[model samples]
Target: MVREKFTHIYARAADRKGGEAELESLLATPLSAQELKGISDDRWLSAFTQKVFQSGMSWKVVRNKWPNFEEVFFGFDIEKMLLMPTEMWERKATDPAIIRHLGKVMTIPENARMIHDAALDHCSFSAMVADWPAEDITGLWRYLKAHGKRLGGNTGPYTLRIMGKDTFILSHDVEAYLRNIGVIDGGRDTRKSLQATQQAFSEWQQESGRPLCQISQIIAFSQGDNRL
Candidate 1:
């Protein structure tokens, strides 16, 4: 049933009339944040390292200093990071070129270790995601706790949504981003947001549903790279 709803949304969003062109536009022009997240394996380490640098700093500052972070962090190579000597850690802790928060600066190694552990247990860092179920947002929160996610807050769940790990309806950013694209209003609170998402899903199920493959084709038509 949930899959049906997802299929429907993809179909409608991927409608062809304006979808293809809009998708082309988005594919042609990349947003900075989007580009950062989309980094390939060759640069994934660099991107993740950049994410750590921004942990306690404003995203804006992190954005501006991304190049420097990449350079100093050795392009995000996990092995290199894991093997970083104590002296190098000290240097980074005081480096004005990076975010200089003492605690965050120091915890980089520990955080990397946690990520490595998660990868070992789950086959990939992405395996950590199975900690949460997709159908229930609240359950997802509970799952995070059980799976050893230290940061637990409303914002944590929202972060999961933003990171595309969970597709719960409490996605404030998705709601707001969709609103910006004129799909839904931004003023809706969490309850209303979930309701809207539920209704949309319900509606899609009632219509003839498409599979992930065919749905991809329709999204190619309707959603058109608007990233909706």
Candidate 2:
């Protein structure tokens, strides 16, 4: 369960699937702090809302209607969304362009306010996310779950990944790998399991000098699945 073991597993998988270069191509490079900081708050809000609504629904449906969502939500303008009246969102529940789920529709403004508040406190929502230590990304996940509406479990982590942050996702294959590595006993999403996963990644980062995203992808790929 050391760094070398993980590397060996990745090497074998890469060899089996057309070699190291191909495996590298499958991994996403994380954005730099400066690049992340430059992203607008509206875009951040949009990404958060997309991930929120995509939860427990077909991603294809969300993807197909994203343009409509953007249109109706005013491009997810944080200030404008913050000012949206309750009745306005209620009316949107029956709109055909976007998903008509009332609870998900309602979360848009609430999450927009959360983004706005983060911007108010830190000058920009991107800055707050960029400032979080990548080595302790689980802490950032915890922060989002506590402060942002409907950003619990994988939602926060998935949002951060889509935003190009240097974080690990506990996907099915990744969880299986973690358990196989003795990082967790039951694959439960508990604080202890998260801490163990974090510590293991920190160790692997030190040993391999790779970003968490790539490391996570390698672990997932090592499980014989192409899904990232």
The number of the candidate with the highest lDDT is 2
State TM-scores per candidate.
0.47, 0.94
Cα lDDT of all candidates, in order? 0.48, 0.85
lDDT of candidate 1 vs native? 0.48
Worst 10 residues of 2 by lDDT: 1-10
Name the regions of candidate 2 deviating beyond 4 angstroms: 1-4
- For all candidates, the clash counts are 12, 0
TM accuracy, model 2: 0.94
User: lDDT score, residue 86, model 2?
Assistant: 92
- Kindly state the number of residue pairs that clash in model 1: 12
